[model samples]
Target: MTNQQFKSTLQALSLPANRSAIVGIKRGIERETLRITEQGRLSAKQHAAALGSPLTHPSITTDFSEALLEFITPAQSDAELTIKQLEDIHKFTLAHIGDEILWPISMPCFIKHQDEIALAQYGTSNTAQMKTLYREGLKNRYGSMMQAIAGVHFNISLPESFWQTLQTIRQNTQPKQAFISDSYLGVIRNFKRNLWLISYLFGASPALCSSFLQGRDTKLPFEAFGKGSLYLPYGTALRLGDLGYTNSAQSALNVTYNNLDQYISGLKSAITTESDLYRNIGTYPDGRLKQLNHNILQIENEFYSPIRPKRNTAPGEKPTEALARGGIEYIEVRALDVNPFSPVGISLEQVYFLDVFITYCALMPSPDMSTQQQQETQENLSAVVNAGRDPELCLVQDGQSISLKQWGQTLFTDLRAVARYLDDAHNETHYVAVIESLQKAIADPEQTYSGQYMQQVLNSGLDNGHFVFELAKQYKANFAASDYSVYSEAEFEQMAQESDQQRLQIEQSDTLDFNAFLADYFKA
Candidate 1:
């Protein structure tokens, strides 16, 4: 879709121009953790005793934007811009948003004595190890004793310098795995699963949460932030800008095409080797070499094969109509983590940070980033994730390495400006507070959640059980006094019944035996 067509469609939908969209993120996974706890309700004294009593504070409290762009126009549909309009928005976002990277690997895992002795399995997904540790035994062992901080992701449009920086990092060379893995998948799954739990607390009907949870054994629920969840909250969505807008049918087609295009591009880039595997894929003393191409092809066919690129259009076809023939457009923000200690499942601080980061991304200029620059961004992001609490890690920007705190400060400075704008434009005071707290965190790194996590670990001796339990305590505290618009007793009963029916429906729909599916899933 062309940019011009896209703008006119927005003029038609009359989507709020100045208002910002917000949604509650909650989860049932942790609630399930609480449900199975043997300790019943933990009293204040009991909570303190569980911790070794170093930094035992009874109470804790916390407080918690978009842009205009030239979107690709899609054909107009249903008197509104169609799906093609959305893709045009993404093209605009891609062309306009800027980003920053944080490294998650450098953070400490906070292993406790129980974790040390427990027979636990690491997840095969990105967050698998933590999930397996927490779900299988940690909840029983720790309760709410854990503390953790997740790395943040900011999507900045690629720029010329961004490419140069990444290329330099890749060329300089380092031995590390690049492909997504079980650990990565686990982290994402846990984080997303928790969002549903939070939403439950946010006044979403029990029916809604339960609907998402059907057939799930563990408390973890559906992936709430489906591909498009992230961008919807951002004020500067692809939905706006100049892009071609077609009728609704054409709009859907455009989104489908874009999604397929991304999948194909990702598959084409999935090449890896023994050096990049979690465990080297090659190096058998007895002899065989790694079949990198075979592994890549397998993933492509099994996973990405389902996606087909949009069919070609005849010459002179309108951008919106042509792309809308097939496709959908959506945004996926991947930086959020479940605030294990917060009842709401995410902190007001975290939410505000996301708003700030996304707004910044929307406003930043897009320069064509090189592969190397992307690698640098990726590496730096990992470092932030893993070592955000560490004061010494250096972040690279404009050809220089600066302390993580310094880099964060610089980022915060920019974010605050955006927050001020959001406040004026959307009348959101919460955004301002979020910016201030982020700035404070940058100034005193220990003040941030990551710092608190390290401190708790030191005081509690990294007991996985203790850490998880303590963290859960904090989570309870965060939401206990706060008003949670939850279902009443009578309402809850109705939802429970509905949940049973939903499960039955799912069971009936399955052709393969449940046990068979389970067998194949676990074996795979």
Candidate 2:
């Protein structure tokens, strides 16, 4: 669509009759960080008893490793309230963990080898064992070192009210749920096309401690930062690039974000398809469970994408089954790196920027992507991750070349207009202003989080490890000095106790043997 046409559509959406429909934009955050000791070594401690059970806790849990803490905030319409809950989670966690501090970045603390990382454990139950076995499969398929890298997932959805209004505006004929599902798929398509901008603006892992490489050979041109660090001078998020969790095997899987049924069918196919490479790892080698089934993807979650259409599943329901049953309830953006500068690992400005971007994707026109176009978007996103700040870099669009700055400027014209409509609907004043700041960051790459943080490392002459440790210490001190604001200490204590009980109940409720449990789960 032309810029003027998109502007007219926004104007209609912002009319008094339709304004409040956009006000119900809901969001949730899932932030992950590794736990490190005072000296910056990865912690060897198990999941602390003071914290709730990692398996059942509503707010706190472990990710791939026991040391990697994942904090979840409930979905709320107000981003400020969501962030405040995150802060309270941080304060309550710090009060319990004695001296260990949360790492301030997406990349992990210095580790000698993958063996130092412990798999996250759940209490012994058929269900819990399946969870661990899935992780074991991940470890066997992709090394544990890659899983150690952390990120923040932004989950968002437009309420039913919003979708209803959108259907009316378009005068669509499909059923409400079907329309919502199709609309969300369009959003995913646009999101993929524009993901490069996100990586350039918020990506923060341009440098890494040399330990992450573990003497592996690489082709990317990386210069030495300090005694024990290697860096790409113009890179944005190395964590989203080849060094982090990758999908080289799934590249040919053809999971297109075209339509809900096709998308679901594509992912399900990978789960049941066997892989000769992973088959060699042996699912039950050494008289013990080494991994899950030797499939291209052991489960739906293993089909790593930067974004996914999600539905809260019923008991024993697979993710695709849930989607087919109820359609898309939300979209989880998995491309974000944990902002090292923010105490909560994501800043309010970042949230606001995403708010504008996501909403614009929903309102704008999105067509089905051809296979060639999908490949181009992936290649463009990879280019930004590896060399976003390089002035000489250009991305391919419609099989033509365009510089990042020029394209971003054009995108902001629509984004800023969308922000104005969001601000009016939400009755908050931050959207337009936040978009302005983000627009500036787009024009000037040095203003991006990765650019600023990497420059600090260069100027301070501290090794990557020492520099991150100092930041982690400062954030720890901040959390320590702050009092609980959103959740009370007593409330947190009660939740931990309740979560433990819930975990025990689940363990006791398991009726099937572990092997039978696996068989039953796959049958679903």
Candidate 3:
């Protein structure tokens, strides 16, 4: 699909009968943040019992560390509602966790040692043990310091009506689910190719406490700030870089996204393959079962990507199994750093812009990404991570080198067009307005979140710890002072109780020993 062809399709979608199909476009968010003390340290606490079980809770759960809270909102057609739900979760959480404040940024707070970060615990059911064991494997493979880095995942799915309209527009004869899966794969490919823009616009992890480096030497040309602070002068999102929540060992695995089967098969191969490095780590270190096995990947979730095709799984279903069973239900965008400026780590304008960008990705024609092409995309991302604000920086596309400004202009033009169609469909002006506002980010790199936030850090002369510590206090107070808008405190308290009961039921219902349960899970 060339630009002209995409325009024609947009024309078709703009028809009155088809445009209304977009009303059902669903989006959800999964935001992760570390629980920290008021003194700017990782909280030395378990997951708050008042918050609910980490296993059965639908809205709140712990991610890698017990102190790391993951807030989930149900998929909603309106982005505004999603933000509201996220805000309500924060309000509820802050009220429950006593004096502890949520880390308001992607990079973690000060840590003295890796042992201070405990693996997220989920009771004693076999399923719960499996979840904890997976974290243990992650700790053994990569240090826990990296896993403490936080991020936001935006999960989106086009409406059934929109897909039906497109299928009819193109006369696609494949089965409905198959067509949806194929189209979503195209979105994944395009998203990967254009992911650098996201890093430039929203990436905000430019600095961190020196402790995150774990006292190791770094190749990055980092400058020192007050006492323990370190930063790159032009860096955008260090969280997405090699130093934060990324898996370097999986770089050797060629995980392709050509089709559902190919993607799933590749992940399966990854988990099944043995690794001598991990084997040397000792799966049973001191006969205590440190990791699941000496495999290259303990499970499919360990294979990190900026974007992923997702489907709601049945009980005991693997992610790939869900995709294979019902095709792609949605795409989880893992590229975004937690927006430091927003109370909920995301904003309404940002969500509006995402709808435009995601729509453009789905509409664009995407060729199968060659291994070299994929490598170039990652190179572009790494470049942006370290020094995206440099005017001299260039990124390669289709074997041609281009300045970031020129490439960004091209993307915004297409994005603006998509935003207009979204306006026509959703009966709102926010989409195009968001495009126009964010378009300035391309013309002036300083308008980006990381660009602006880094200036504040430099000007304050306070250490990274005190700067973010001050900001976090404001967010904590805001959550505390504001009354719940979506769900009441009593309701949230009841839900926590319900979640605890559910976890207890699952524990009571366990029929097999942990060993037999693990064996049965692998068999599936």
Which regions of candidate 2 are displaced past 4 Å? 2-5, 283-285
* Residues 374-423 of candidate 1: C-alpha lDDT, one tens digit per residue: 43553454344334444576766545777766656665676676676556
Worst 10 residues of 1 by lDDT: 60-69
In candidate 1, position 337 carries an lDDT of: 38
TM-score of each: 0.43, 0.98, 0.98
lDDT of each: 0.30, 0.89, 0.90
Error of 2 at 5 (Å): 4.3
Please report the TM-score between candidate 2 and the true structure.
Answer: 0.98
> Model 3, range 5-57, lDDT digits (tens) per residue?
78888889999888888777799999999999877789989888899898999
Which candidate gets the maximum lDDT versus the true structure?
A: 3
Model 2 CA lDDT for position 337: 94
lDDT by residue (tens digit), candidate 2, 376-482: 99899899999999977899987999999889999999898889998898887899999888888877889988899988888888998899999889888988888
The CA lDDT at 14 in model 1 is 23
What candidate 1 gets wrong by more than 4 Å, as runs, is 1-263, 268-329, 390-392, 456-464, 470-486, 510-524
- Model 2: lDDT to the true structure: 0.89
